[model samples]
Target: MDERTRADVERAEAALVEHYPRLVRLTYLVLPPSTGRHRRVLTAHGLVQRALPRARLRRPDGGLPAQRGPAAEPGYDVVRLRALRLALAYEGRPLWGPAALPQVWGLRLFPRVGGAEELALDQALSAVPAPVRAALGLWHLEGLDEDAARSVLARAGVEEPDAAQRAAAQLDRETETGAAALLNSAEFDPCTVQTRPTDLLRRRQRVRAALALVAVLAVGGAAAGLLSGDGDRTGRPPTTAEQALDPGRLLRTPNEAWTDTSRVDFTAWPVRGRQAGDRELLGRALRVWAAPPADARIMTSAGTSTRPPDHPPQLLYAGQIDAVTVVVFYDGERLVRYAEPEGATPTLHFARVDDADLTSGAALVIGRGNGWMRYLLAPWVSDVGVRDLLAPAGPVHGLHVTPDAVTDRIPVPPEGGTGCGHWPAAQFRPSTRIAGTGVNPPFLLTDLNDLVPVHLTSVPPGGAPAARAGEATGTPALQGWARTACSLGTLRGAGVRSVDNWAFAGQRLPEDSGSATWVCSRADTWRGPGSVTLHFLPPTTRPAEPGRIAGRARDTAACSSFGAPVVGNVHWRAQSGKWYLLAAGSHGVGGIDATGGVRVSGHTNTLAAPAGRNAPDEVVGRLRSGGTVRALRP
Candidate 1:
């Protein structure tokens, strides 16, 4: 072509190359590693390779075919948006299966996290709703601003700029709280040029199977791999940190994040093989239950040092599943649960050791579920050293043992749900993206830990559901609210009432339905103690209406001693016909006067802090005899 065209192409290619890594990561966020029905289509590396050519070449080159109506060279936002659209359109669905929801909504929910586990990029994205996922993929992962993110979502079929704005705001909250670390840590490995995706799939499977086989054999009896394997040979033996490779280093200890043990009901648990050394039994467990390749290593070691010498050592089963390195924990022949560390390397703690203790390695693994630390330790390893390395150096917590457990492996239901209800959203396909291709309402943002259902018997004009009599019931429901209260500091000294603290909670309210139940725990607002629940009904798009807001605050411990109950009415401001929840203390923390002015008390107990614009429809407010009021959002 002409020299000018050639120059434009060159500049475009350079920009593409410079942004290639981010592009790959973005594409991966839109489509992540999975073994579900969409596996063949959601080829992240492949999609990026294909979409790179369509990005606005240069600031001066104008838009590509997918991007028209743009004047000068479309910015990187346009390019990234195009790439996302391309990825979503792949294989006709981002994910597949009867349950797969558009925008990856069909997966298990990832509610608010409380610092126990470190989620990988894919895992984190899997927890987010699809629209929010897309918005975040643009904002955080792709580095787009709110306006640009709104534009990108618009192009990708999200009609409401306000919704995109809400998603962007939520992302900001997540990043501020370190919730987005997993997405930040996610990386996209370069894909070699290939003609077909099947080839890549076959190669990937074969490699995983081979490694798994080796790992199984090594854990079973062979120690050759550990001694000769490539690791830091800088003459110094590797410390726990040094030995922890990617995935492992990135992984939190069993006690860290949400472990599989968190969701299980031990009463009905199923058992696996009887003893530890039963190669056939262990192998079968690995193959079917652990879902590892036949050859992955299996090193069964008896517990020592930190535990009763006679107690069975925890069996460390290391292998590859779906190209990911994972270590499964077992009690005797029973498969308790499994963990996936990030990389391909074997964990030093779980690595197969040579020489003595072969008998212990083959002995039946046992545990009282006192705590995983003691059971997980290797024979020769020092308990103190490893514990100090794995956890923040401090007083050791006793092993969290499961007692009187009847069965072995947790049962996997028809939907592939391991008795543990929590599944990686990526792995579990749900349905299509919510409010498809339209200006859908923003999803209600409640505590990820809150499981209280918004009873749907009735809803007002803004998509918020009315609370039912039994909206908050069940162990999980209480645990959800308790965790949320704990996070918000309402239960500062009260702590979560139960161990099942967090899980995904939130709702996609219907368009035209206004009003929802919001609970502002004293902890969330840092306003003394206890929590208040209220029905938040913002003014309708048509006209402003005076609505009475009411709620109750309970379970408040220490803060209950605060003098005089705080009082306030919920209020909203109308802008462009859309109502926004006026956060408590926003109007200068005062009681609203006849002229609609607010008055603040020197020491008021408002249940909520001021919620910003784009706040959820429902919010909780506390009012006292003085007519002073404070409100918070769900």
Candidate 2:
């Protein structure tokens, strides 16, 4: 969580200047040479011209650190590095995978600049593709592991590039004797440079002086410590000895044993589900609850370590399920935490951790019924560690858990069939204890039975208007035609097909029974295992007519489906409810495809941003403020 100051960079520069010749030689190996004939863009003349000298450095101290190295050099051009990575990637060269690149480089030269060279290399990585270079540098240079690197590579989309024949040819030419010629060899150490005789002699003099001075200081410091009878703390301060430095240790670690998971596969992750019954909702919406595949891996993140890509992991995590969102959690590239809502109040999560679980960092707090489901998104992913990925606009989380953070498992008071084997909600004891500070966490109760169960009396076939469940009033019915065009991005959600517009209907009188209607599609709906639907309706409800939007805003479905026989129906029924006609307009069933066609999308992760489930093409309201209109069929 600590930030390196500009002064730290200056110190690195001085080190570079003091060791320019070797550094240049190292850089030269990476570079194709400055020969005029160089067309591979080893000629970084233009890019280096703009970038290098412009490079600036700062030290840990607020004041300036001595500068003479690349940090201080006017031009800290890294076009060569960028060019190198691009060439390797574009040409599909058999260089190290992105995650292990830096560490692999370290194998060639053990770094000893006391973090200076390493820091510079880390910075240089940004000049290239962030994911690839960072992953590679972390694996090759720093001491990350295979599990850590796998996470980085997945984020970078970099994999084992060369095949067997290519790899064999490359190995023959690179195996010790014929190594340096490979484009990605350690010969490219930017720090290694050609040196002049005079410069070499001066370098030797400086090195000798620096080493001699260090010896004198060490001996003097030892004598002083011995004479004073001072205690030694090894690398740590005495006051902090026995102090736990592993940030991960303090976290409420995942009961890895409790979670059932598997390796990540392109297709086998999503479980089979139903195409009939209440399976229909919206034109297309991602099945909210997904049972990860038994074969999916845990998405091993070795922080760019030695783990090879082909080696499958033991669990498929939320990130692997949804790549982009997961990267937001695994990458440590951000610093702040936010608690934006699916439909909750906004706040911030503030915490700075050097090494810790994502939950250990500041977590944006949120609340829903039953104290269940607190979704958080952290910013600055994967810089310090995988925990840095999720940064969103949420509340500022202090050091302790909030009331909303503690959720109780809802008890199964018998509306049920085949309950879970473990802690069944029916056995859970109710506690008068309030949630949060000093109180035991809330317990699950047959809480729903107390609230009026919404009733669904069919309206038969009628020409009426549609509104939020339990709040329909007189309005123009859906007219001629209303069709939203689906593009390649339309079905991009995880197994999402179309939007579902299902809710309870309110009659003119309060005493009348509430009815339900459904608007959905069956584009990508599948029938499989452990499928669940979560209604993440954050109460964005403004004052409706006289009071509040009284409809229950809770996700209410989680069961096995056997509806594939009715896939043609496109409409699914609800358990706590069923469908009837308010005023059916031009609502129909359809799906979008790739190339802006229909039914051409390959999978869900590739679905484009915001697939229009919550989007509204038009509005209908009373003749005045126009502020009270409800969003109709998504």
Candidate 3:
């Protein structure tokens, strides 16, 4: 053999050995999932193992070219392209020969089961066409850009490579997850798989009775066909009830139902949009919900189901919100919003609100575009206003609303930054009857990139009674929120239903220093588990200076009513240049204790002990009710 051919062979061999597991994983992700887990595992290993050059280096042909860009290692790229092509070919048609090498018998092999997020992503990827799946695998698993993905697809013999890439991109946008993150999960990793013994006894019995079972099945099939007489010629079952497509059958409440209905939830929201009676619009929306088109973008909040409603849904509102045609529907369990922009693909969003209440169901973000958002208020809403959470004393600007209850566009807050200059929150007052008093208490709602906005409430310091939503508008409450509103960005897309900021403790600093306050913010999501964060707001005159995040915990109920009291500590240096450890807890916390590098205890909910900068310790709060609550980890 020529020296060049020998070198090519050696390079290919080296690459195959070094990146075997990664290449196998890539092929497994690219292959169609219909092959089942056992066969997919074996096939992926077989394809990747045979990816190296055979004996000689033939001229690079029209086959998949070496990938460029980030994964531009010549040898690795060559083998990856070969393995990818083989997987795609296998997806087009079943392998004709005997089972590939690395086969196992009498055992079922499959990857470990992943969490809900991974399962959802797997199902989504499996729904797309094989070529599109390959494109996604390239873009995410291989970390390639659109251009690079298109090039790889074209070289791999995809007829419409650009279309495949576009479809993959559309799916990525709809799923709202980084494909790489899901692909790296154990659900797709075939190398480390779980094994289960096959039903060997059942298999043997099946083998013996195969012919007899087939004969009986053939006779039964003939009898059933003769009796059925052309059942469902379309070959696809109906996704929704018969009346779901009939727009006239949609349930609608009267415009003034809220005044008399005992139920104060969305059940009383009157259908009051300009296009509420547009059958064509309503029919299209229902059809998309039943079976979304290939090009439509669909989004579902975590834990929200994507199934169509079993019965005709209630029509809450159907009208133009901003520049898009919007349709809102409510089944008993889920809230679905459909938005279509002019000359653009439509989007369908679903959020679970089965537990929505008077305060949580007050407002919904109906439209968002070009850095602005619009809200659809409930029938009980009497007035709408906008407040800048950052400027506690700023005037609450009045927002104009159409006759149909759709508010004008309000600018969205910037996503993330240290300098939270402005954060806009919607403030609306419910009818006095709904409030059950002479005063129409105003409620606060902020858009967190979900169909329903999150309710914002606050509690004053010094164990004062927890106030209603209106009291959160007070200067002290607003200032406290201003110091922590930016932190709310972390809760975006987390299916959060409401957030409560409780200023649970106030402590005097040693050496005549100014006081400090400890606020525990708990975000409760629609799905059960929520998050808790503790903030340390030092005495500051500048409102823009945000507080420090002292501690945080996930899936915790601390700081919420009836939950464990939250405790946290931070080492602070007073203006006098002396450092000390300060700890505090929620109301009912009988005492505080610090362990590890520093040991200290207090008879009250607050504790102060001198310590150095590097003092490491764990703090626990002892409840007056004979229980202990640990501080959240930083």
Candidate that would win on TM-score: 3
Superposing every Cα of model 1 onto the true structure, what RMSD results? 19.1
* Tens-digit per-residue lDDT, 282-304, candidate 3: 98788677655545776777667
User: What TM-score quantifies how close candidate 1 is to the native fold?
Assistant: 0.34
The reply for model 1, stretches above 4 Å from the true place, is 1-4, 31-42, 52-71, 74-82, 91-136, 139-279, 283-597, 600-633
Residue-level lDDT of model 1, residues 410-485, one tens digit each, is: 1111122112222110001111221222221111111111111011011212222212112222333332332232
Task: List residue ranges in candidate 3 displaced over 4 A.
Answer: 1-240, 433-438, 464-471
Model 2 C-alpha lDDT per residue in residues 57-146, reported as the tens digit of each score: 444346555444444322212222332334334322223234223321101221111111223333343233333433333333323465
For residue 5, give model 1's deviation from the true position in Å: 2.7
Tell me how many clashing residue pairs each candidate has. Answer: 73, 131, 0
